[model samples]
Target: MNRLSAAFIAILSLSSVAIAQSQPVNELSRAVVQVTAPDGSGSGVLFERDGELMILTNRHVAEGYTKFVIGVLEDLHQPVVPTFTAILHSFSPELDAALLRVTMYMDGREVNLRELRCRRNASDFCIPEIRFASDVRTVSRGNEIAILGYPDIGDDELIYSAGHIASILYEEFGGESVPMWFRTNATISSGNSGGLAFNPATGEMLGMPTSISSDAETSTSLGRILSVEAVWRALEPDRVMTTWEEFLPPNDGLDPAMDPHYGGTELAAGFEPDLFEVEVLAGGSNRIHTLPMECTGYVASAPDFRLDWSGETTQLHLFFEAFDNSDDATMIVQGPGETWYCNDDGSGTRNGLDPAITLDNPAVGTYFIWVGSFGEGDFIDGTLRFSEVSRNDF
Candidate 1:
């Protein structure tokens, strides 16, 4: 061969080697585990929280089954079954996300972290925690992505496919909108559900493989990937760190439980509470805050608030007035106990979409307030007011 041709060939060989070295396929594969339910099998990503291990998968994979088996792919595509038992911790059908917590074995067999023989270490089985992409805004059309999972075609072998983002879709429901999924040409099939879609350049998870679509007349390859934001939102309160002061302040007020409103038998004279104002973006783009109150309810949007009430008596009144009347907004108040309250329009008398809540004999404790837009275009720019009322007001 000529000298120039030989030099060109040498450069191409070196470039291919560098590219292969950059991809951490082995490490990424270790984070992907085989999840088998009573009816079928799929893939899941291993995550660690507070020193305990958990698996993040699609709800359909673990739904209807109280318990399932988690196995790691060993050499020659064989799966090494760990004695660990995974129990369903939480699942959301809307988001298509499920969280499974790993409990000790049922047979009383002791297993150490090093016994799983996961990534990086031969002696230790500790699976490395997968890093999720923080900003979905960075993922744009045509961005290169990769999927790691146990595709049925692989026969229990961890498979990797590289592709690029094709299109993005937003699903709107209950007055909120969010990036639902991204369409891609990534080679995904049965058993690939719940597998992760990551940026090969950064190794940051962007989404999760959920399903694939095909055209009958024309040939097209596209897979729908659920955005990682859904997973992050479902598992946020446990993962994000914040202090009590961030939600509410120390209680300093006359005992209202005995009298109801600040004053007994009458509304408290000049009982005015300061208005707390917050700015929230549309489409649930902000971080969701946990309310100090202990109750069960869903916050449709971010920029939520909490109030601590130790001196409450019988009736509680909460008001939310948004500046944008055209913006359809909703307010939810959950607290004290199992009691929950929500309002779409405050009194239905005002021009703006304001929400008001009145609770009688509310349990004395913290209360959570969530202000959210009803659709994709609404932004939260308003004031939240809290007051105590007499039982008669209710």
Candidate 2:
């Protein structure tokens, strides 16, 4: 039998015991998988979005591993014989959560899961809809929760635990207080890090069980679940990308090595005027690259100007000046070391609504610059300025 069929048969054999013991385990445990990481073993919860199967686990469980093994089971105490290989897609340390995508079922054939499907009256291999609670924070203290995961004691088998919410915790981010994690009286162990904590009444997942706190004297432990809000926040493309490599690739269709939209300018430190300016029409058809901060604007696919800088400088100031003072201008600079700098409204430092960015201790290298308007499809006429002094000086 194929790996998927073998897994399905194993699940079916345990359904009888699951129905007698816990109804939630019979239905929801199919989505929980045992994840084997470099450090050790933990659990992961499977979720389907837009026809793709994704797994959610703790960062400590799956982080740093490009690939790992996961075993899917539908009942507690059922051994995970057929395993699948999963790829670590992304991780957010702030949220302490990691996302994985399944690639293939681990057999000698290396069969792809995406290509396999259930046929009418012919196969038991079928993917089911794993539902998560939309209103995650609705359950407060005293609400009963059901958890399914692979604890070390269970070996390769999934384990089910029952508990109640003990308390909710909050953290501040981006000037807002958000739900961070919740403590529960769930019996979770070292191998349960990335499993599901669900509402038994609704059969919907509430959050992920990430860590457990123990009291040696009392011989008791409290489980800490990373809130569902934190999970969604971590999954966001913008918030999860901390490194420069995670930034969005340039889509302007123009190569940085090519000639700029406007001619290139060579500037050296301690130049005669200490100021260089170029007049050009701004805005382009391409949307601005996804930046680390609140950068909203549009620019041409090709850079408007290229700056070849020489020597050391304390600060290099780049700003845009629209002919119409009311026009909202913006700027993008691809500096040395592939670092990106973008500015909108200049943080209100400029005289008007123009955008400005000051690079501190600017390095001597080539800088590809783009000047654009805050609004899309806007071709505002503006003067791009480069100076050693700040915009306040001009």
Candidate 3:
């Protein structure tokens, strides 16, 4: 061969090797696990959360169950078998996602799920972590991607599908529009829900393959991916630092000192007669759609009820009590430091669909509250209650 031709071939060989080294596909695949619940089975991605190993999957896959069987892929030829049991850690019904905390192994050996590394065996070979693309805004249409999961069709083996971004969809939240989910030509099947939608070149997760859209007449199907933005917002509260500004409603120019629409009350940290309440109309012109799968409702610009708190050594509880079952209200509190807290539907037995928010060691400042309606622009009558103890205590 001529010298120039040989040099050209040598450069091409080196470039191919570099490309292969940049993308560690095998390591990324190892993080995928098969999740088996009483109702059905689906895919889950392993990630570290609060010093424990957790599996993230679609909420539908974990329906009506708190405990689940988790299995890790060992090889392609062997079927994935149940290796351990995981407990439901937390769930977001709006986001359609659930987290499972890994418990003890079948062999009785303690495992560290909090560690970044998830091992296939006792060997050093492991998937440290499945890296998620930091900013999904950078992703554009036509970007090539891959989906990894334990699809039912694959019989418990990890399946990989390749495709490209088809389109991006936006949804309105808190009066602003933001990208929510995107359509992809990638093939997402029955068991693909909650699996990783990844960028094969960089080995970064782009989104979660959650559902598939199909046309009856045309017989055409497109995969729908839950964008990382929604996923991040859904998981943000658990993190110490938060990007709440992105999800909270925009300012409507209402001052805190403005007269509360529902009137107001004052309470000290250790005040006697612990519970206080005010009658108010919930909901207004403003809509809070940005908080995906969490708080959703329409609130007014001004505070419905204002609380003059004298600071608290213990946690403070602010909740709404609907007079009847027909009303569903939401609560938004702008407290000291301008921090915002929101909640929809109280967990207490009697609270039902009423909203509640707990402020840990509430600061000594004025709190502006908005008791909102779950429906747009609907006025709801409810009682805004404040207590030092939980609503259940009452």
Please list the C-alpha lDDT of all candidates, in the order they appear: 0.65, 0.76, 0.75
What's the TM for model 2? 0.53
On residues 149-185, what C-alpha lDDT tens digit does candidate 1 reach at each position? 8887886677889889999887773355767789999
| TM-score for each of the candidates | 0.54, 0.53, 0.54
Question: Per-residue lDDT tens digits of candidate 2, residues 53-131?
Answer: 7788887676445678877763334586456888878878466888888777787356544543323432333444566
Q: What TM-score, to 2 decimals, does candidate 1 have?
A: 0.54
Candidate 3, run of 10 with poorest lDDT: 239-248
Q: After superposition, how far is residue 297 of candidate 2 from its true place, in Å?
A: 47
Deviation from native of the Cα of residue 304 in model 1, angstroms = 49
Better of 1 and 3 by lDDT: 3
